[model samples]
Target chain A: EAGVAQSPRYKIIEKRQSVAFWCNPISGHATLYWYQQILGQGPKLLIQFQNNGVVDDSQLPKDRFSAERLKGVDSTLKIQPAKLEDSAVYLCASSSGLVFSYEQYFGPGTRLTVT
Target chain B: AQTVTQSQPEMSVQEAETVTLSCTYDTSESDYYLFWYKQPPSRQMILVIRQEAYKQQNATENRFSVNFQKAAKSFSLKISDSQLGDAAMYFCIWGANTPLVFGKGTRLSVIA
Candidate 1:
């Protein structure tokens, strides 16, 4: 089976610019997540989606950051008017479903460098 | 709210030796999951091992094993017969749903 797929492994943008990252999760997977990993820190959950609906996004910066899992197969994370503090690796992960305890499959994250 | 902690900022081990990474967590839920994820230079978070809180027997995968102490709220990873490829940042995580809480990872270096 194919692993989670992400586009534009590295991105560079100026502060206040808008940037978007895409993720295509493993086929048949029902849950998808987006996380941010700053240097010397662990990945922080940004948002989570179960199928086409969001499960949790309490930690997300709703003022600037937004994500959507359209059609429940692929998802996208966007940061409008990005800040310098947002310069970190954005990771995408997916799991099988709610009942099973399948391990999360992660993709090669998109490293966003805001100058 | 659940939180994971990894006090070790960095650790090193010799090839063929064993090294243990310590992790402690805080949670109120009786049923949850613990995980060890490895992130190498490629930047992909790979699942190394996982354990259910209710399970008594430790979970082991290949040369990797977990020492899960539910009472103490501690979970640690022990790597036996360490290899050069094992050198990476290992993150301990806990959660029940899509959002997982991770500890500050421990960077492990293996000497050849």
Candidate 2:
């Protein structure tokens, strides 16, 4: 089976510029997630969607970060007027959503460098 | 909010040796999941192993195994007969009704 796919494996942008990352989940997967992984840290969930409907996004920064899972299959995460601290790997992951299951297939991630 | 902690920032072990990475979490929920994920230099997140809260027996996958102590909220990963390819950043995660809360990760180095 094909794993989760993400576009722009690497991105470099200046602070205050805008950048967006895209993700295509595995076929038939119902849950999608966006995570931010700073250096030396694990991926932190920025948002989660259960078939285009947000399941959780409390950790998302509303002022500069936004994400949407249109049609419940492909998702996009955007950061406008980025900051230096925003430089990190933006990882997208998907899962089957079965009960008692925590297996999530993750993409290679888009490495964002904000200068 | 639930939190995961990996006390060891980095660990090193010679090839064919064994090493354990420590993790501790704080949560109030009774039902949850614990996961150990490996991210190599390629940056792909790979599932090493997972343990369910209700399961008494530790989850093992080949050379990877987890020691899950629910009462103490401690979960650790042991890599047996380690290989140089096992070098990666190992993340301990706590899965709840919401998203998975990750620890600061432990970077493991395998010297050949």
- DockQ for every model comes to 0.67, 0.67
User: Over the stretch B27-110, how does candidate 1's per-residue lDDT look in tens digits?
Assistant: 989999999999987767799998998889999999999999999999999999999999999999998765678899999999
Clash list (residue pairs), candidate 1: none
Report the Cα RMSD per candidate. Answer: 1.4, 1.4
Write model 2 residue lDDT over B13-83, tens digit each, in one string.
99999999999999999988899999888868899999989999999999999899999999999999999
Model 1 docking category: medium
**Stretches of candidate 1 exceeding 4 Å from the true structure:** none
Q: lDDT by residue for model 2 over A1-115, one digit each (tens)?
A: 9999999999999999999999999999998989999987788889988898988899999999999988889999999989999999999999987432658899999999999
